[model samples]
Target chain A: MNKNLYIKELKRNRKNFFVWLSIVFGFTLLVLSIFPYMSGMGEGLTALMEQIPPEIGKAMGMDEQTWSSALGFYSTYYGVYIVVLISIYTASTGAGIISKEERDRTSEFLLTRPVSRKTVFWTKIAALFSLTLIFFGLQTVLAGIGLSLVNEGTMDWGIFTRMHASGFILICFFTAIGVLISMFFTPKKNFMGMVVGLTFGTYFLNAIAKSTEATKWIGYISPFNYMEITIDPHHAFNYWGAIVLILVAIILLIVALKSYEKRDMAG
Target chain B: MLAIETINLSKLYGENRGIRNVNLKVERGEVFGFIGPNGAGKSTTIRTLLGLIHPSGGRATILGHDIVSEGVELRKKIGYLPSEVHYYDEMNSRELLEYSIGFYDNINPDEIEHLADFFELDLAKNIADLSFGNKKKCAIIQAVLHRPELLILDEPTSGLDPLMQNRFFDLLEEKHKEGTTIFFSSHILSEIQRMCDRAAVIRDGEISAIENIQDLLKKQMKKVRIVFNPDAINRNLPIGSQNEKWHDQKVNFEYVGPIESLIQWMNESKVVDVVMEEPDLETIFMNYYKR
Candidate 1:
């Protein structure tokens, strides 16, 4: 990878990087703030949550018992929010990292430099992964602080860390998919649309799978289901799921680099 | 080694032919012009040499490096100015230039400063705010700041005013004197005539002729119009008369033969009026295409 291109991309995307970081941090803080009040309501809150349809609750990866535990409460609501936001952030930024040159009409300037197309492609991926790593670190810190402030009893740090780690892997997968999508399409809006469609379409499939045993196999196709607390209640690392996600990411990235190298760029 | 060489280079856009059997050679340190009308494959050939598009057949090289297999290394010693220049709009000119220079490790800062000063460009302005001519100037500076061994410019003077165009040509002459090989492509024939030592004319995806500037000028034809008395209309006229037009008592045509022969033919007829004028490049260019 070329260090110059990586550094230049980091500097070029500084503002967008910070904005994603803020969204991650702010979302974590907002969700963790309500933990104390929910814990105080106790059995009354459990009864009310149970009154809702069991199918819908299952679809959201939540149950009456989840309200009593801090980690479960975090997973049931805040987890989905974090995953969706991260999906949006990583997918859009990753796609923009390469496709922006085409849209902004700077592909000629950048591609004609004394660097190979492979170097440029890898440098951009490195910069994008670095941004995601930063976002994860900041969000983890914010979540830890929020949990400490709202602590009314013992909490599980191990499960929290494991869940966030799994999310990071999923973010990498999303980023790979995003960068691949950018290679096939030239218009920015169309690529962004595909990102959203793929993100939410898989999510709803996972949700529908949760509501019925007959459709449970559909959840296997959605990356979000890999870390859903309702599916893996113990939060143990799903080695098979992780392997599949990683392999797909690697394959997508290889295809993306090859396609970018051969494309006839029109300026 | 030659500065640039292409053998039977062909590129086809699906069924539409881009360029066919295009063979060209430019010696080191020579200024070669590529002239063609719009949609006549001038840009296609240049883009292929730059490795922006893949060719359907044949091969090419610049400075002894194959354009396809060794493009990255080949680009290290070459600079290109596209016909239409665009850059990161958010970057100021200074930042853009700095980022551009970052691709090469040892570019002298002094050269960048010299080019900026020569072009009279304001480096602090955002690229989005610069006018088209100003953007063209910025393109010129970036292309030459590295002092590359070869420069490929495609229609490099589209938006510049007459004065800037002249200064740009002078700057190019200075670079030529310093032994930098230049491949200049333009639709404007006069610019090619003014700046290039030799020129190749392309039409409908083929090179029709490649000639020295002096030889090309010598062969250029003149527009001749003669008005004769109605009774003196000669049925037999001299050969090499073309694009003829006849009115009631006036006749117009292009003359490509010896001037002495034309004068003798005019003396034989009762000539009322005669006018001889140099034809523009388009007329001459169209004539070549017709042949």
Candidate 2:
């Protein structure tokens, strides 16, 4: 395969990349606008916490917050957002990257160029990777905007950096997962569903396993449980399960590549 | 040298049916046309050459390389316009053209512009807004802009109005004059007859016959009709074995071996009126399909 073709695809998909980024950033802005502050939120949250049933508060991660802080905000909102956003973007972009040509009937024109099929596939993957970066970067800006709306005072850049760092890892995790799902599914409408489902499905399993020591191993199954981001190093989120996630992502990408080679494109 | 050659190429789609035992050889720089009905496997054969669909049996070679195996390499030299022309709808023509630039090496942007101008295409219009014929022109511009060695067009003029259709053929003829090899498929008998130096007729997935225009006309049996007076005696009548009433008069009909026999029959039958029908490619193609 040619490397130039891959780069070319990345350049060509600029419009789609921007569209995806806009959707992600727009949602981030919505989330930021809705929740304005943690400083005053703690008292109100505490009052509500008193009335809430124990299980519901625990599920919301509210019971885990000792006091309202940026780190605590990460637990209740930003952290969860991290996993969902990554999962959604990765799965959508991954499945779409390769299958769009087939769905659009553009593969004949695209593949007929000097590029190889493998090159085209990888190029689409690279374009998605770039799109993921732009998406998260926009969200991170939206993250700052989100915070400023909630609190007028300047925030510690350290928290922002840490959160964004976890975001970077999450994006990769999504990409890898997306690639895996894209490889296995056919170019039908259900392909995107399968990819999207995998992300949510794994996250659900892990969330359920987090509460039970007996089924605790199930937490490791979901890629979402691994994305950890916080202010402090010891208590800060690290998403160290990234290693396992990355491994799985690689294996899935390989499966997708092999599947593309073996399967005939649908007429 | 043959630029493309297919030997016993067949494709089966379960019980639905597909092309079978198809053979063709298109020499370099020749404008070869594959003519067939709607479901007669014209597009199927083209798809096989492009490696979009795999052949169940036999093999096709392009520039001396197997299409399935060397498809990646061969694609660079071939430009194709699909029958149902569709493009990325979101981008305007300029943006789409800009995007395709990355896929190819060293294509002159100005040349594309010139072609667009020649074809009177509006580059700023989004594909969704363009009419079907305009969209087809876009597909054609893309296929030819790169100036590929071999252009494979599938019913490239199916949707064009007659004026545009004539213009398209003229453009194709110009492409041929440039020494570019063309292998196009079409269902329009007139267009194929006008454009191709040599054409193949495909029916029911098999090629019933391949012949040049002269030979085709020569091989067809003439239809000679003779109107005889109702009062004419029966002994001097021609060898025509059937009779039909036309304009309240008796007419003898026969598709005889030679023009001389038709003439003899007409001369002896006290013929009041006579007419002879000559065969063209359309009739020959239909007869070939019937067989």
Candidate 3:
């Protein structure tokens, strides 16, 4: 990968990075802060859960049985917000990374340089992956702080690691898919629409699948199901889901690189 | 060795033709002009040579490297300015120029500063705030700052005022004096007339003619008008008179024959007045299109 281009990509992405970082941090803090108060009123919380239908609870990825624990509450409620926000971040970055040059009419300048298409493709991929790591790492740190502020000495570090690990891996999968989509379509505005569509489309599909037994097989097609936090087992990491995520990510990345190399660039 | 060569180069976006059977050769240090109207394939040919778009057929080479197989190496010795200029809006002119210079080792900072001064461009201003002409100045600076062996410019003066256009030509002349080969592509005929040593005229995705600028002007057809007294000679016109019109005592046509033959015809006819003038490139261009 070309260092100059990689650095240029980093500079271009820095502002958006901070904006996403603040959003995830603020959202996580607000949800985690309410956990302590909800745990204190156990009967009221239980009564509220009882009033809500089981199908709705499952659709929300909330655990009715483990709603009392700090990590359980976070994995149930705070988890969805984190995943959704990061997915938007990853998908948007992946969509914009290479196509933005064309959209901005700068491809004529960049592609005419001495750098090979392969180097350019891989450098953009590297930049996207690096941005994902930063987003994930910063969110983890802020989540840790928020959990400490409300856990009252009962927070489980092991469960936190496993949950975030699965989330990070799952984000990688979605990011690769985003890059794959970008290779086919161009200009920033159109790519963003596709990013939003695919991210939420799969999300709602996964929810729909969880709402009924007849549709559970549909969840297999959605990346959201691969990293879900299961309740009965107590926030255990899904190894097979992690495996599929890694494999799919690798395959999509390969397709992206090949397609980018063969495709024509417009100024 | 030739600075640039393309053999039967062609590009097609599926059924839409970009360029067809284009062959060009430019010797070292020669200034070559490519003239065509909008969508006439000037940019397409240049893009193929730079590997920005792969040729659908045929092949090309620049500075002795195959355009595809050795595109990276070829690009190191070449500079290009596209038809329209766009830059990273977040950067100031200085930052963008610095980023461009980073790609090439051994670029002279003093030369870059001199270019910026020649254009009267404020390097500290952000690109987003710059006018179209100022952005064009920045594009020109980046393209030539490397002192590349070959420079390809497509419609380089579209946004520049006449003064800036003259200054740009002077800059290109200086580069030419230093033995850099230039391929200038434009729809405007005057710029090509002022700058090019040889020119290739393309129409409908194919090269219609390639000739030295001076020769092209001299050999092109001349418009002829004749006014008769009361009686007009109805005798058959000369073999080379094209699209003749007859009305009252006036006759107009285009003549492409020896001057002596025209003089003989004028002497025989009851001609009160005879006017002959060479047509400009625009007229010639239109005539080519008409064919």
Q: Pick the candidate with the highest lDDT.
A: 3
Predictions ranked by TM-score, top down?
A: 1, 3, 2
lDDT of 2 by residue, A1-267 (tens): 456555655666677677766776766666555454544576877787889876455444455352455445643555455556555766676777777777787776666666656766666667677667767777777777666656544566776676677657766777776666665655666565665577667656655665556767877766656765544445454545656666766777777777776555544
Off by over 4 Å in 2: A1-37, A41-58, A63-68, A138-167, A179-197, A230-240, B225-277
After TM-score superposition, the amount by which residue B214's alpha carbon in candidate 1 deviates from its true location, in angstroms, is: 1.3
B1-291 per-residue lDDT for model 1 (tens digits): 999999999988866669998999999999999988788898899888888888889999999999999989988889899899889999988888988888987888777677778888889999999999999998998888778899999999999999899999999999999999999999888888788899888888999998887676667777888888998887466788998898878888988888889899999989999999887665666766777
lDDT of 3 by residue, B66-108 (tens): 9999999999999888878888999999988988887778887
Q: List pairs with backbone clashes in candidate 2.
A: A36-A150, A183-A256, A228-A237, A229-A237
Candidate 2, residue B281: lDDT = 74
DockQ values per model: 0.59, 0.46, 0.57
Q: What is the per-residue lDDT of model 1 for residues A64-133, given as tens digits with 9 covering 90 to 100? A: 6567776677777644677667777888888888888887779889878889888899999999989878
Lowest summed lDDT over 10 consecutive residues: which window, candidate 1 chain B?
B280-289
Share of reference contacts found in each model: 0.62, 0.48, 0.73
Which parts of model 3 have CA positions greater than 4 angstroms off? Answer: A186-189, A208-212, A228-235, B14-16, B220-279, B283-286
Error of 1 at B65 (Å): 0.6
Question: How does each model score on TM-score?
Answer: 0.91, 0.83, 0.88
Interface RMSD for each predicted structure: 1.0, 2.4, 1.1
For candidate 2, give the docking quality class from DockQ: acceptable
